[model samples]
Target: MVRDLDHALKHVSLRAPAPRFERPRPPRGVFTSQQGFMRALGVGAVLLVAVLPFMDASRYTMSIATSALIYVMLCMGLNVVVGYAGLLDLGYIAFFAVGAYISGIFTTVLGWPMWAALIATIVACVTAGIIIGAPTLRLRSDYLAIVTLGFGEIIRITANNLKITGGPSGIHGIPTWSFGPWSFDDGFNLFGIDFPERVVFYYFVAAVVIVVGVIGAGRLAKGRLGRAWKAVRDDEDAAEAMGINTYIAKISAYIIGAVWAGMAGQLMATHLSAISPNSFQFLYSALILMAVVLGGMGSTPGVIIGALFVSLAPELLRDFAEWRYLIFGVLLVVVMLFRPSGLWPATAVLPWLRRTRPTPPAFTEATAVPASVMESVDGTPTTDAHEGDRA
Candidate 1:
């Protein structure tokens, strides 16, 4: 019986496994990949911004544009915390307040140059970030958010009460950026096209800061630190097991975000030549967080769009007078309803840009079995019925 079984096994031939179905790849080209396309779009946007003042250098236009750029800076920073690290910060504006107030005090009270004041602002923001993040980052989700909210309120109240911060009235006459003898207030002529203080400030200072901030945030999101942030965001325990220090990742994100917000605050103070407790209210914090969510967290392009929409939508709808805010709220609700993941979610792909490929046919049981496998050692095909009868 053993010899007969061995003979039968020798007669049976095994077939190789079926080939795996591979999806067809799109043709390689400059715009074929998402990253390449985004790069091109970013270049175009920068160029457009460079020439925008030439089109309309009006005070109203520059003011609105500058404000939108400030929003962009703030949103980018918040994106690092909430979007990348998955830390919900409800009191982010506190860092902004810190930067503005510190700069204001250094320049106006201490009679320091804007450059010196800026250095102070950076240090103060970093310290504030550590103070707030060190204690609160241990808490996750809603608890973290609540603590941040309280911290924001504390900063506002402190500013309102402190005489150095000008009390409730806040600081005014904060000087524009300057380096020794040269100053932004002096303005400059380029290519025989003379520019005024407002134009020079908007073009050189605000635009440059915003561009640097955006690029810096984007770079950070693509580096090793960014990977750790994403890992911690996805699964803290898994990341910890993989040797990532979640605490350090969270704190780094918080600190970077604080510095970004602080720079924006300094810019704002110079733009308006003032800083008040009323400006850093809880409402502004909520608005900044909303912009991050609305634009799609963890997405650079989406965040920029969200910031612009949140900042410009009100002004665009101002023709409606008192009904503008109502319309704006309705629009936001409608957008969220339709695109819950965000208008441009991190995973989103345009239909037209998607790779086109025919669907492969599904596998079936009939195709799984080979004819040789059903044959007997005697060279006669054997069916289940025949085998059962013989048994």
Candidate 2:
């Protein structure tokens, strides 16, 4: 029986159509290949122009750049929460307040080092994240936003009434960020560039911090946790059904966002040598959220663009200071109406977007057979024999 089956299979193999695979053809035209080298070249040129003049720019310009960079960092952090996790946090400024207060207390009253203060600021912000995110995240969407908004106001009010936080007077004379020997207050000489010239040191520090934050956010977006966050963002119910712990994922997003905001707070405190409840107002929170949304929520580059627009648009329109906010509001509304995806939408477009592998030629019964009949055992021509031989 085995030998007969093998003989039948051999016959079938001989008569069956050949199976083959074909390679895919390259796409023609309308292609947008990633050019990282060219992108890097353009970015390098822009940075050189923007930064090389820092040693000579006026104090006002340097201050503006520093503030803009800080905003960029904050937006990236918030992007993780809103953009990645799809959580709308309205009181993000609360974390910034926590960081500034922690840094202020550690540096001014406790007489600890600035680095130590920064570390403590992060810890405090993380603690704040848990304390706030725990009970509040239990609520869905709009309610969560309201709770966060209330929490932010609560933080600001507490800071206003607390003595350690300097009450309404706020904290003053907060020390500059420093390492073992390099005091940020004493700006270093970059080649011939003096650190303190027009407060260039702050810009230098801010640039480093922004770069680090951007890189970290990008890394997080591509890591395992990032995928989970995105899964939750896309569909919380589905993600939960798939065994992802939505609660933990949401909490992680808040903690990361809080830490980022805290760092920005530290930068703000050092830049102004002060901390105030006014600094963490609802307007600032809205502004940061604006940067994230206007840029491209989940996109790092988009968020950077949004931050620059939010920060520099007002500065550039200083000549029209009377209508600056009006113009800004108009521009934002225009952007949302026309290009709702964002200034740079995260959608990736390219030629031949669909899979383009060559398909095998299908053979039918008539096509598979030659224009001839097969003979039976008696040598009489037979269509049945030919049909059977067609396999």
Candidate 3:
């Protein structure tokens, strides 16, 4: 009996331990992952926009669509500052003004080509960004907002007074984009289909807004600088402690946003062939900011949706005439009351659309160790090997 017990003990000790239990991973399915779903959504949106002009082909329709696209570009740029960097910039339109004025002066006054004006616009916007951001970024919250608001007013007033900017009348006769002898005024032929000037311009704006405003900003948000921006936004002191230069991060975001707005301004200048002081008013800034907040800050899709809604809602509600503004305000209030975080916040998840995870197996007799194995030769309960090793 003693020999048999010894042999049993030896066999048990030498045997490999039962395989550790691991919760089974959820099965992968189409659109199961957030990244896959977002990618699909973005592609679908692009396809929809690309087909819209084909469906209507009307000047009125194209104009509205183009305007909406411009709004998207502007909002995306602002999204970088307000959404990603957590900065409340009330003067973002200043950059837009800078781009418009520069492009106008270059193309109209200096008699430079549209391409050259574009290059100058970019440089001016970058310089303006540094000037505004370097000094003001150190301030936080309400103070920063106030300072930015003042800056916006100052830019508008200065534009209104400047002779080159055409004072209150603003710059007029701003020419369309041209490359060498080819201009947007001359439409193109693609795949045997003749595209009109308006249609071509619409396509051009769509490409720029989607590529630079949407994709570029989205890529930036996923990069190292973007991470630093987020860290600073969450806690400036904590980010600094972690070796991040909070000032550099904040200013970089400001500068990138300025460049984006400047590009949008140039596009707008070409689209309208004119720009006015009234166009860059505080009200417009408020509307843009409202779009960002309504769409959910830090969310790219949400910002785009918000911009479209703000830009197109009035037209859609035109049947109400003068009461449209009141109705718009009421609707905005209702949305805020219901969804304070914006229509589609960054953390939002659709429960119905989400893939369900299988429940982990419950503990049972089969999973429990045998009483004999739990005890030592002297009959005292054996402590866990892992616990002993940890001790």
Candidate 3 Cα errors over 4 Å, as ranges: 1-29, 353-355, 358-391
Flag the better candidate by TM-score, 1 or 3: 3
Candidate 2 residue spans exceeding 4 A from truth? 1-32, 35-42, 45-56, 190-193, 197-200, 348-391
Off by over 4 Å in 1: 1-30, 358-391
Candidate 1 structure quality by residue, lDDT tens digits, 156-211:
99999988899989998999988778888898898999787888888765565556
Q: What C-alpha RMSD separates each model from the true structure? A: 8.1, 7.2, 7.2
TM-score of each: 0.84, 0.80, 0.85
TM-score of 3: 0.85
Error of 2 at 260 (Å): 0.6
Give, for candidate 3, the lowest lDDT window spanning 10 residues. Answer: 362-371
lDDT string, candidate 3, 170-257, tens digits: 8889888888899988999999988988999999999999999999998999999999988988998999999999999999999999
Clashes of each: 0, 0, 0
Q: Pick the candidate with the highest TM-score.
A: 3
What are the per-residue Cα lDDT tens digits for candidate 2 across 143-220? 999999999999999999999999999999998867787776666687895657336555555565546677789889
Candidate 1: count the clashes. 0
Q: After superposition, how far is residue 350 of candidate 1 from its true place, in Å?
A: 2.8
lDDT value for candidate 3?
0.88
Looking at candidate 2, the ten consecutive residues that score lowest on lDDT are: 369-378
